[model samples]
Target: MKDFPSCFGESGVQVADFSSSTSRTAQNLVSCVYQCRLRGRSRLITVSWSKNLMGQGFSVGIDDNTNQCLCKVDIKPWLFSKKKGSKSLEADSSKIDIIWDLSSAKFGSGPEPLEGFYLGIVFERRMILLLGDMRKEAFKKTSATPVPSDPIFIAKREHIFGKKIFSTKVQFCDNGQLHDLVIECDTSAVSDPCLMIRVDSQTVMQVKRLRWKFRGNNTILVDGLAVEVFWDVHNWLFGTSLGNAVFMFKTNPSAEKLWVSQPLSDPHMLPWSWSQRFQDSQSQCLGFSLILYAWKNE
Candidate 1:
């Protein structure tokens, strides 16, 4: 099989491990979550980018506060004949339009474009979510008014592959500087297994006795904001299958509110409880989370 590079190539790797067969062909995906108001009610938007042997593609989904999907649209991979187009959909009796132009877009090694393109989501001719650098072209093509309130980026989930060193880029807050996130761990070193996490080459967190503390949470400050880090590497340490490790970085002071029903004082308790359901909002304010699933290359 041939190896193809994605447009944004921060962190993506493939291994030849067939121990479980499932981990041998893990899907490459990047999903970004945004919080915004729709018809006076809070809603969430998920934009997912994906790539496979066929080509690069993307999907846009809208969900209500109740966690119900209101609408979704998928743009087939670069079809050559339709690199730029628009689609209109209806949700809750309201009109929604999605437009994009990737003809000249440049990509790194990831499925996401690096520049030269724009993806716009308009509601009633009003721009709701506009991404990419081609802002002027997007407005002219969609004939949309400037956004009244900017959407808040709340979360991002991405899959990465590597051997012992995995790296990616992240921004803790809107308009914040993008920092390099690097995770180094050698699971094969059973005698002295350790884990280290660094941001912008600066070591922010480290773990010893990997076998004992495979699941835990810690806090680190970034850009003057407190970020709680949760990790689960139990699979890498002891699982029979070649599994992936999960890591989440949350940047919300009110994040503790999500665990109000749980035992906060218990040192052995995990805030997320190894579950992927972390959508609790007690306050009107939105929070941000970055989840990375790191898979080791055989």
Candidate 2:
């Protein structure tokens, strides 16, 4: 199996279909729908409430080969009452947890489900880093915390090497220049993790470190940063950021240039219209609709 990409690259998972009602004198009412997709299938697995008082929620996982239910798990909370002030409280109190075993499941058998193909994990000795927006104070506090000794699970087997993450992008950087590894820890439960890059004589070390401050509501963070040594021409292309915008530095480390696609104002214009000359050879020519609108007082 392939190694999983860090959470920094993982796409967001969203839960939908929640409805509730409550009275001023009572607890808040809540009901929600959770949906998950089965690997390699067009079917979407949905879990929701049942009208029966004893039946809190039900979950279903589909098998693509059979086009039938692979597993059906009932989630009945230990306690539930319609008269209760909050529907969510009742559901939570009566909910059941179920873990599925797919060893004998058909997801990975036969032709191998398109969504269930496990990509080979690619490991690199170089340290990984990330950078993004974060609260200034939180960043400072985390920086002062002591590093931890435990191994950090950057990605789960199902997430990185699993068959689910297909056609997704992965980026890696290894520059010789030292950089501050910044990360934003959003919850009090999770300690901010760090990557320590060090080199001695001929050996290179990438250490996993941790910080103390609880990230709180801050969602943006500078994951990590590094300056790479130029070894070969191919390495140069892969060493830089993979996004559309990147900062390039000169040999002196004093001069820098901002490389960006020229802004296109015409609503009908395609992204290729604004491509820089250097990117023309490597870029794909794709057209997309561009909408522009502004509100005006009548």
Candidate of highest lDDT: 1
lDDT of 2 by residue, 162-219 (tens): 1111111112222233322221111123344332222222222222333321111111
| Window of ten residues with lowest summed lDDT in model 2 | 1-10
Which RMSD does model 2 reach against the true structure?
A: 22.7
TM-score of 2: 0.16
lDDT of 1 by residue, 185-239 (tens): 9998567689999999999999998888887778899999999887888778777
**Candidate 1: TM-score?**
0.84
* Per-model C-alpha RMSD: 7.5, 22.7
Name the lDDT value of residue 183 in candidate 1.
Answer: 94
Count backbone clashes in candidate 1: 8
Give the alpha-carbon lDDT of every model. 0.72, 0.20
Which regions of candidate 1 fall more than 4 Å away from where they truly are? 1-26, 78-81, 257-282
